[model samples]
Target chain A: MILGVDPGLTRCGVGVIEAGANRRLSFIHVDVVRSDPHMSQDLRLLAIYNGLAAKIEEFAPDTVSIERVFAQENRNTVLGTAQAAGMAMLAAAQRNIPVALHTPTESKMAITGNGKAGKIQMERMVARLLNLNTLPTPADAADALAIAICHALRPAGALEGGEREQHLTPAQRQWAQAAQRANHGRGVKRGM
Target chain B: MILGVDPGLTRCGVGVIEAGANRRLSFIHVDVVRSDPHMSQDLRLLAIYNGLAAKIEEFAPDTVSIERVFAQENRNTVLGTAQAAGMAMLAAAQRNIPVALHTPTESKMAITGNGKAGKIQMERMVARLLNLNTLPTPADAADALAIAICHALRPAGALEGGEREQHLTPAQRQWAQAAQRANHGRGVKRGM
Candidate 1:
């Protein structure tokens, strides 16, 4: 099982999924853990930590994937996001489960084959890929599922270039080809 | 006892101090908790959380004071610093100790009577106030001590304007007068 988290102070999104043979994915659970804004920041952070810790214990995921945060993004919210991300990472680390960070662009590209894909497009892609009949309400949840899928499709040790095509499953290879086609088509259109 | 933290991923500084009648302060302990830069971000954050958690458990402080972080500061280190601050706050909250945030300006003002006080001046004031024969070696350790003193001098509920001079002890009032004098002297000099 792989768990994906979109960390935030007010509402942290968490999604768990399992990858099967041939790279098929199944969604296990998705939810938003919320903390009151009126509460002191320390208490708010502790609430987030506790909420995520419980989910990790319940799911016992093999690996945890979280959206990587950058200080440049949303200056007002970046600090809280970083703090929330820290809690998510800490919860997984305490259990000895490996944690991975995927950038927003990486997740968007993995799901919609477009690094700059819009929210609705990403959500549609996530629902279609997860084989869900309905959309993942509240964009954060969808974003989290996309993060998890990004991890599942990533080549092992791909970030460090430790793995190559030979290690990719047939399904992942197929998906990679499709993404490349999408990227090429977009590039050509922009060049026009 | 009060615990103060100067949060950073590379070296989080912690200081424990005791406050007696008439606002006298005694330094109990001070140390820096470090996380290796070579480790993964998740593991490094976990190491920080564990190190601070252990300290909180050992000292059983009545309150935790941490340096407030702003995204405007050094973009390169802000995220890591915010994450470290989160860990410090979480460690205190988990143990039910109240946590307070004091900005660098607030700490400096409390220690040196100048919001723009330089590093060397802040260290000297912290050492003098704590009656330490030698200065707090690492800047982070001294910063933590300064944060603690900030909280100790602040009037109860002062941040929210809930308390007034009637509640302040003689020592606290005297320190406040001294700080005002320093600020006035600096203003006069700058005008000249």
Candidate 2:
């Protein structure tokens, strides 16, 4: 099982999925953990930390995947996002779970075959991939599901130093080819 | 007792101080908690969290004062600093201790009567204020000490909406006068 977190101060989205053989993934859980903005920063962070910690305890995920926050984004929200992301990571680490970070572009490309895919497109793709009857509500939750799927589909040894092509499963290769085609054969780096 | 933190991923500085009546301050302890940069980001953050949590447990401070982090600083280090700051806040919150945030300018002005004081000057002033025979070794440690003193000397009800001037101790009034004189009577906002 893998847990993916889309970290934010007001609303932190968490999604859990079980990955089977041959790039198969089954949705296990999805929800948003919220904290009141009126609360003090320490209490707000503690609430988010408690929420994420509870999820980790209940789910017992093997690895936790979190979005890689960048300082280049909206200056007002970046620090809060980074703080929430840190709490998510700490929750996982306290449980001795390894963590993986996936960039937004990587998640979009993994889910929708395009790095610049729109939110609706990404949500629709995530729903279809998970065979869900309804789309994940709130863009943050969908993004988290996409992040989990991205980690689930990642070829082994891709994060480390190795020839990614040699480790790609048939499904991953097919997805990579589709992503490349979607990019107009521009040669999108595999598993980047 | 107040605990001040200068948060950073590689080196988190922590200082404890007791605030006595009439603006008198006594230093208790100061140290730097460090984590290796080569470790995974989650592990590094976890190490920081553990170190801070341990300090809070040992010291049992009434409040934790952390330097407010801004995203405008060095883009590379701001996120890490924010993350470490989050951990510090969480550690305090876990123990139900109140948390205070002071900007670097506030700390500098509180210590040296100058918002733009250089590092050496600030460290010397902090040592003098603490009556320490030796200066705090690392810059981060001195910064933490400054943050603690800043919180210790802030007039009660200054953080909330109130007339700060009515609550200022004689020493605080004297310090404010000195700071104003240092700023060439530019009327620096009190307890801002």
Q: Which stretches of model 2 miss by more than 4 angstroms?
A: A157-171, A174-192, B157-171, B174-192
lDDT of 2: 0.83
The sequence of per-residue lDDT tens digits that candidate 1 reaches over residues A81-184 is 99999999999999999998988877776676677889988888789878999999788888888888988876443323534556565544554665556566
**In each prediction, how many residue pairs overlap at the backbone (N, C-alpha, C within less than 3 A)?**
0, 0
Error of 2 at A98 (Å): 0.8
By summed lDDT, the worst window of 10 consecutive residues in model 1 chain A runs over A183-192
lDDT (Cα, tens digit) per residue for candidate 2, span A62-81: 98989989989999899999
Off by over 4 Å in 1: A157-192, B157-192
Q: How many backbone clashes does candidate 2 have?
A: 0
Tell me the docking grade of candidate 2. Answer: medium
TM-score of each: 0.85, 0.86
